[model samples]
Target: MTLSEKILARASGRDQVRPGEIVTCKVDLAMMHDSGGPRRVAPYLERLGAKIWDPSKVVIASDHFVPPPDVDSAEILALTRRFAREHEIESFYDMQGICHVVLQEHAHVLPGMFAVGGDSHSPSGGAVGAFMVGIGATEMAGVLVTGEIWVRVPESWLIEWHGQLGEGLAAKDIMLFLCAKLGMSNDYKVMQYAGSAVTALSMMERLVLCNMSAELGAKTGIIAPDAWTLAALREGGHEVGDDALRWQSDAGARYERHLEFDAGALAPQVAAPHSPANSAPVAEHGGVRIDQAYIGACTGAKLSDLHMAASVLKGRKVAKGVRLLIAPASTLTTREAAADGTLATLVEAGAIMLPSGCGACAGYGAGVLADGDVCIASTARNFKGRMGSPGALVYLASPYTVAASAVRGTIGDPRDLLAMKAAA
Candidate 1:
């Protein structure tokens, strides 16, 4: 069996399982954010009689609408808080940024665990080898009540990346390129990332890669635990032992499909408006003027992402007609960026800093684009009306490309800017 199959089999108390088989597995962790928490609360209480399966395994965070856009949103948050308090859940995080980031920073989701969340991007936990899947509110409520979820074992699709990534390229670019190549049709499949290139990525970069599994219509994305994974878990305060490191695919593990890519040949990629798979090389779309540039969200707001943006924006100013927005993924990352002067460098370049939440990515708090405007964003999704008006256009790219475009007021490649800086 594949790594995912092995993990699912263990969670379901089975020695082995095959693809397309249905299994009810014990959930190690259940996450709910403000957007889905309120809705699940009433149904969960009504269905399960106000008794939670386990409070310690439940994580509730206020992220989608951080400051609460209106009374309705505020009440939703209040309801979530009330539920957490009544249940005495110690994992409640209020306005602490994205739930996935909080989970990682607190080491709530560890390797060889089965996790489920209300939001679609819950696969971000797979960065640490956890099988984290996103389900709807109804399913989430059921899991909250019973502490179990029934999932069909997805066929595994192996994506092997060899060689080193080129300058100005990022994990975001690699995913976009893969989305374009794979056509985003992973209905009953899991994306299994491997090879030297994938192993070389940092924990944050791997998180960015797995977080976009939603865009590919995948059940989730996963990387087998390795030495780097162990180090990352320890750094995040998780006391991982040899048992956790034993969750690897068998030698003869089967895969439904396999694809390989040369990471060294990749260029900075950009997805056009309306779809994440509608992508092209960044240099192919240069000079497409942009009105806004944003870098934040679960897929793009890590401290390393901020550092990349800062490196490009340092000693430079955002273009006259452009509005640059920077949002960190978590309070922890925000503090780290501030201490390292990444926040200051971005601010000095005229970037507006927002709270460590979804920000403009979900079209909730700030940096909403107007009709007829074009935006270059480091966010995961670029569907119509994702960032505001349906008439507006949103292009998705890496933080480096977004910051470079912000300085030029157009879709631009970071390599060009970086090369010029090196020459100077």
Candidate 2:
């Protein structure tokens, strides 16, 4: 069986399980944020009639609308807070960060665990080899009542990536490239990343790789736990045992499909307006002007992402008409960036730093674009009207590409900036 299959089988108390089988499994962690928690609270009470099944296993984060853009959003957050307090949920995080990043930083997700969240991108936890999946409000309420939920085991696709990534390219570019090639048809199937290139990615990079699997219409994305994954787990304060490293795909595991790529020859990629699969190399869209350059969201606001953006904007300023917005993924990341002067350098380069939350990515808090405006953003998803106005256009790219475009006032390539920096 695949690693996801093995983890789900173990959680369901089965020796073995196969694709297309329905199984009820005990949930290791269940999470919800402001966007879904308020609506779920009433259903949970209606279904369970008072007490939650497990408070320790539940995580509630006040993200999506951190400061509450309006009175309605504020009321929603207040109700969510009330629910957490009434249930005595110890993992409640108020204005801490995005829910996924908060869980990652808090060390709640572990290898071989079956986790679920209310958001579609909840699969981000799969970076640590956890069998994480997203559920609807009704399903989440069921989990809140019984600590168990039924899931259909998904077939697995082996996506092996080898060779070193080129300079100025990132995991986001690779995902975009794959999305363009594969065209998002993997319903009820998992994308299992492997090979040397994948293993060489940092934990945060791996998280980016898995987080975007939602764009591909996948059940989830996962990687086998390895020495690097163990090191990251340790660094995040998780105590790793020998058994944790045993979570790997079997030698003769069956997969529905297999694909391979050489990362060394890939170029930085961008997704055009309205579709993640509508992608092209950065150089192909050069000279396209943008009004805003945004860097934030669960997918794009990690410290490494910020560092990459900072590298490009170090001694430069955002173009005269371009507004660069930087939102860190979490408060912890915000503190780290501030302490390390990443925030300062970005600010010195004329970038506006906002509180760590979903920010403009959700089209609520900050940097909303007007009609006819064009934005080059590092945030995931570029669907129509994702930012604010339906007439506005959004282009998704890596942090390096976004930063370079911010400086040049157009969709620019990071390698061009790198070459100029080197020549200087």
List the candidate 1 regions with Cα displacement exceeding 4 Å. Answer: none
C-alpha TM-score for every candidate:
0.98, 0.98
Per-model RMSD to reference: 1.2, 1.2
Candidate 1 lDDT over 120-151, as tens digits, reads 99999998899999988878878878899898
Cα lDDT of all candidates, in order? 0.89, 0.90
Please give, for residues 303-348, the per-residue lDDT of candidate 2 as tens digits.
Answer: 9899999999999999999999998999999899989999998999
Positional deviation of residue 424's Cα in model 1 after best superposition, in angstroms: 3.4
- Candidate 2 pairs with clashing backbones: none
Q: After superposition, how far is residue 314 of candidate 1 from its true place, in Å?
A: 1.2
Candidate 1 pairs with clashing backbones = none
Total clashes in model 1, counting residue pairs 3 or more apart in sequence or in different chains: 0
TM accuracy, model 2: 0.98
